[model samples]
Target chain A: MLELQDISVIFHPGTIHEKVALSHINFRIEEGDFITIIGSNGAGKSTLFQTISGAIAPYQGHIFLHQQDITSLKEHKRSRFIGRLFQDPLKGTAPSMTIAENLALAGCQGHYFSLKPILAKQRQQMYEALKELNLGLEERMDTKVGVLSGGQRQALSLLMATYAKPQLLLLDEHTAALDPQTASKVLELTDKIVKKNQMTTLMITHNMQDALTYGQKIMIMKEGQIIDVINSERKKDLTVEQLIHLYSSKTNDYNDRILL
Target chain B: MLNQVVVIGALELGSIFAIMSLGLYISYKVLNLPDLTVDGSFTLGCAVSAVMTLSGHPVIGLILAFISGLLAGVVTGVLTTKLKIASLLAGILTMTGLYSVNLKIMNDSPHISLFDCSTVFTPLSVFGEYGVLLFIGVVVIVVTLCLHYFLKTQFGLALRACGDNEDMVKASSIDVDIMKMIGLSLANGLVSLSGAIYAQHQAFSDSQSGTGMMVIGLASIIIGMAFIKKDQMAYQLLAVIVGSIIYRGILTIALQIGIPSTDLKLLSAILVVVALILTKVKMRRKEVC
Candidate 1:
């Protein structure tokens, strides 16, 4: 479980160019809670994820993971218990390194790196995991990730993120760059992986259908604030059209293009 | 007879510089950092080794030289990582600072001569001119093998990841700053080792000896990579060593053909320019393919 209290992020504070990115945002995530966050651009969705991952320090807030204060933890230190996937597949994996090497790196969470070999067992595990994606990555374990297609790279990125089973998984529009079919495939895998691990996940997506279809909870955001959070009971029966009506009614600044 | 001497001398010096090129490979190629500190640390190594050897501690001299190189790298790493200075600027700052430190280490002298001092090569003196060659060859092999093995380790993989994609490394819970510090230290340490041995081999350590050393190392790396299959980590390292030798051979040939010794630095710059241009062309061709 993770919690953020009174979180605020201001860019270039006290200057004419100053803008509040996140403001007094409070959020709590329960164990095994799969949260799908929907927001238009500048809604502070990425900032919230960055704050949780310790990439950006909140100007005024406290972050807690499992009842432990983690606001001051460095980004790399926070990553031990937090797995993150970025919108750009290239950002999530090392392109110059092989798939096996990337998996080996992910598997090293919470463990000291030693001089010992990465082990054949670790490679075997990576191969099996890649084989599950049905992307033929198992046959090219030694191939540099740079040569892989975007969908294949994102799939491998997903595998790397969850390989260690971190306490919290953060996906920031991870499938946005893929084509429709590939995006759906990745989303399906995301759903399967989350269910299999019972992972506490926070995913941000612009796709209204994806928002309505996945996760036990759905939260809508506007202007650095969470306007509404529909729980599993309400979320099970919620329609995209109704969600859009509720959003437009609340914000009064409807952007129909976001529904796509 | 003169050609044979030139060839042998080139090989001897080339092997010594191969160690330095390997160090540069770690910083420039592996870590993706252009560390100019090598320009000073190489001389610092020679200064420390020369001063220590003159005082009858050849082994201690080498160890101290390596340690000093590590400290120099730490300074650069801290400046770049903690102070958030640009890596190139940090290297320049450290290199400038090391100038005075090198002078101080040499007791205010610009140069030290170990001509009469016993060195690591003294025990192999019975092999005559081959002593220096043998000593340098063994050292290069040991350093290369150790580096090859180290790069294959988990820690080494993390270090490589730090260079290739720092965000991915951070996401994996590996501290990018610490990895950079460790890598810089190891790289500069090897460069210093090269300087230390060079001081003993040449029987002199001048503060200016390390001038243009970075370009030389870069040239060697670029040339070596062009000749070798770079897909494997081990082969890439071997390429650096071989590149150093070939670089030296080219310089030797230039000298044999009546090129002035004073123009050697110009030659080094030209070599780097050509190597870089060739690399760009190759990359462009690959893209076209």
Candidate 2:
């Protein structure tokens, strides 16, 4: 299980322009539990993910992975345990690299980059993985990733993320860039891969439908604080309207927050 | 007439520039930054190598040249990454700083001469006739190939990712600062290593020799990448080597045709501009078609 204890983050802290991006964020995610996070603009959803991924350390709080305190670990050290996919398709994968190279890189988990050629069996394994994407990417393994369309790139990014099965996967609006069809395809692929790996994941999505459909748990955030948490049992009876009602009731009663 | 000796000279010259170009490629293409420090660092390589060779250690000179360049590159990286300076300005700052550092390393002078020393290639005369070029060519090829293979490895992937997207690389658990440090240092190291060889080949290490070297390296990279099929790493490296030769070959041809030596700079700029335009054109075509 992953846990965040009283996580608080302040931007431009102690200055006149100080803004609390997150305040005393406390949450828990169990292993193999897929969670979807929903929040409007400036709701601290992105900030929460950034903090969790070790991109931005919390000013106050302790983060633990499987009961091991990971708050002090550096970003790369954290990466050994967590995998992330960004909203921008171009952000996750190297554009200049070929599909095969990208896969090879993922296969290596970005380690030993200066030694060892991609072995034949590894190459075949990567090819087989790409083949499941069913985009004919297996045939275009040698093609540069820059030449790919947004959907294709996002799919490739998904593959790269899952290739090195980390304990926790972070999807930061990963399908936000593609067309509806492509996004649906990528989401399908995501569902398949996430299930196949049985990986614990925290996925943040702006689409209300998406949040309702995926992940065993759903979270709503207003300020830095999580307002509601719905588990699989409770979420089964929940609808988009009920989710919005739950989010609004808690946020409206809070008084200080001007929800976006 | 393409005289055999001149052809060999062009190849040898190209090989040296190829090393510099590959180094520059890492900084520019991968890091996505304009690194002016390569100019001073190139000379640093030469001065260190020349001084070392003069003191009777050619291998030490070569190794030292690489290390010196690598250190200089790291300084540039530090200036940008840790200090949060703009990339171009950081490079310029380091480049200016290297001017003095090079002088100090060379004992308060901006130049050194390895007039009668055993450089890595200096003792290669025993090969009889095509000795120097052959030996340097082999060294260049082997080193380039090794780097090429290295880039295909996992560490190299992380390094490339650092250049392409620092945020993503950082998210993946690689320190962006550390990767940038390696990129800058390694890039300049290659350039300086070539400079060291150039110093020993011509038997002089002058500060002026480094002037416009960054531009020359960029020009070589642009020319190489233009012809190199994008996405083909091994061939891309080979193209850089070939591009350096072609670039040098053009200079030689221009000289043979009696073009005034003073016009070389203007010509280089024109060549780079043309290549840049072509790159845009190709990219745009990809969008349209």
Candidate 3:
């Protein structure tokens, strides 16, 4: 379980250009809950992810994971349990490293100081994992990831993030860079991995249909505040049109790009 | 224009410098850091080796030199990572500070001679004419093999990845700062070790001996990498060794052509610039086609 209490983030604080990125944001996420977040541009979606992942410290708030306060933890230290993926596919994996080597890095995350080589057993495990993706990446385990397509890289990035079965996963527009077909493919893979691991995930998406179709709940954010959260029961019968109507009715800000 | 002895001497010098090139391989190639501390740490190694050799502990001198080099590297690493200084400026600052530190290590003397003192290679002198070369060759090979295996380890993978993609490494729960520190420290350590050996081999240690050492290392890497064009660790390291020898050969040829010894540093700088320009032009040509 994770909880954010009175979280507020002010960018460029004390300056004339100061803006409240996130204001008094509070939420409690249950174990294994898949929550899809929807918002227009500058709705503090990515900023919320950064605050949760310790990438950006909150101006005022407290965060608790498994009932322990983790607000002051460093980003790398918090990464032991929290897996995060960026919007840019290129930001998530080492381009110069081979697929096998990248997987080895993910597997040996906390034990990074070990002098042991990537053993044969570990290589076999990575091979089987990649085979399950059915992308034929297993055959190219030694290939440098630089030449991989955006969708392929995102799929690989998802695999690396969840390889250790992190307790909390944050996806900040992971598939926004891919073509429609590739984005949907990577999204499907993400859904499968998150379901298989029963991981607690918070995914931000601009596509209204995706937010409606996936996840157990839909969270609507406006002006850095949670306006509404439709539960699993309500989310089952929610339509994209109805969700968009609910968003516009509460925030009065409508954008055609979110329909995509 | 070259004698057999001069060729052999060049090979020996190449092998000794190859150890230093291996350090540069880690910093410049693997870590992608243009660490200018090489000039300072190289002399630090020489100073420590000289002082230790004069005290009748030649082998211990080499170990101390490597350790001192590691410390110098750590200073640069701290400045870059902890203090948020630019990497280039950090290296320059550390190099400048190490000048006084290096002299202090030498009891404020700018030069020291080991004419009567024994060195790590002294014991191997029994093998006669080829003894020094053989000893240096073994040392280079051992250092190369150690680095090769180290980079293959899981920890080494993290370090390499830290250079390749810092964000990925941090997200993977690896400390990028610590990795950079380790890379810088090891690079300087090996470079210092090379200086220690050079001092003993040449029978003298001079504070000015480290000038333009960074360019020399870069020249070796550039020349060697152009040949292999492969990403494998074994091949890459082999390229560095070959590059060092080739670089030394180029200098030998320059000397043979009647270039004064005093102008060797200028020649090295010119060679590096030419090599870099050639690489850029070749890359542009490839892109055009």
Candidate 4:
């Protein structure tokens, strides 16, 4: 469903502050694949996600989505096929909108905007989706999102990210900010929805345990290098300490030059 | 006699100021940006609409006013979103540039008058004595209602999102740049619309009409919000409308108590700053308590 070939991204390439964030990176994922990426700080985790989502152009390489080259597409254009969740809870959803209003925006994707109100049918559909989250947020169809709790907002954001039913979901630590229990619950909801929808997903996580436990594959990034790629087969047998060992050894030489 | 004019002056001036406040609501309330372009675009609207009205085509005058205001707004959006200029500086620059643009657009005429001219409201004025005030009132109510309807639509939701959370909207696959452009256009439309109405009603559009308009709008919005606390559509809509009326009322009462016309701008500025501070302090106190 997604492919990145020999992608090289350098920031300020020739300037005094020039640094390589991603260097000749190659990666691939099959359709219906859910890949969890784990990386320490400054390992270009976010940058990698950005590159895949076309937030930033990869300095060198072709990005393919389902087969078409999408490297040159702008973030908004690529967004139709991709859904993203940021680490910051406040960043993932409009805080001042009703849940339904936010969902309506996502629902209206790829359609020409007219002077009409959100259709009654679309609102009913949104209500059903909100109800399924089990957050008791469906009643909040008219509530301003700014008044929602952080966890609720993040969940709503997750729901919005999926509202348009994108081909790929990129979760950039979506649950990283929630209380542990809320985080766990959100992840559970994520699992259920992603499986039901069979969405091709790539989620970056700082939580090593989460990386190992969720998703069909686990990939460790170290200094812009994919130190190890483990499929469900390998992921099942892996442990956190062992994965850390692999990451340190493979990326030791580039640790000093680590760039996010 | 002077006191009577102050009563009339307060309502008339307040009504005009309401126009700016309504525009501010779009940018600040809906879009959540401290857009400063209004100061310039209000004048831009007045300039175009006033000139066109004086030339005997007030409908075209208003349309041109809105279009020109939209252009000024786009320039501000580009400066901030595309050029990465700071919000405050972008507004200041736009306002400065508009001085020259207004001059050129008006054939370097310092002012334009519609004393003998026909405006969008000319036909409505067959009622005679109440013509000017009635025209302004109808314009405000109609435009506000249209905006109320517009803000309830899907596109409006996205525009609101663009204000509160750009990332989420982007994640949802909505383009923030396009939203910003459209938002600014709509916001400035309200401001320029006010300017257009003000031009015809006053029978003159001076380059100075738009000066300090931002402050006046803020004052009205702050006052309006003070009266309406619910986040529901009706409340928000009511807040802008009532806030405008009350703001004008306060100015009227103050003028009745003997404040000079020359100090109205100063009074408006003080009104805005004080209202802003009061709201901030109230919110803070609520959080603390």
Specify the highest-TM-score model's number: 3
For model 2, the docking class works out as medium
Candidate 4, A22-51: lDDT as tens digits: 989998889999999877777888999989
TM for candidate 4 is 0.92
User: Model 2, A81-138: lDDT tens per residue?
Assistant: 7889988998878887778877776766546435777788988998899999999999
lDDT of 1 by residue, A24-75 (tens): 9998999999999988889999999999999999999999999999999999
Off by over 4 Å in 3: none
Best-fitting candidate, scored by DockQ? 3
All candidates' TM-scores? 0.98, 0.90, 0.98, 0.92
Considering summed lDDT, which 10 consecutive residues are worst modelled in model 2 chain A? A251-260
In order of TM-score, best first, we have 3, 1, 4, 2
* DockQ of every candidate: 0.78, 0.60, 0.88, 0.61
lDDT ranking, high to low: 3, 1, 2, 4
lDDT of 1 at B157: 85
Residue B277, model 1: Cα distance from true site in angstroms? 1.1
Count backbone clashes in candidate 1: 0
Which portions of model 1 miss their true places by more than 4 Å? none
Q: TM-score (chain B) for model 2?
A: 0.93
- Second chain TM-score per prediction? 0.97, 0.93, 0.98, 0.91
CA-RMSD of model 1: 1.4
Residues B1-289 of candidate 2 have per-residue lDDT tens digits of 7788878787787778888988988888877878998888888888888788888988888888998898899998899989999889998888888888778777877667776667777567798668988877887888888888778777787777777766667667677888888889899899889888888887878876787888888888888778776556778787778788888988878877888988987888788888889999999999999
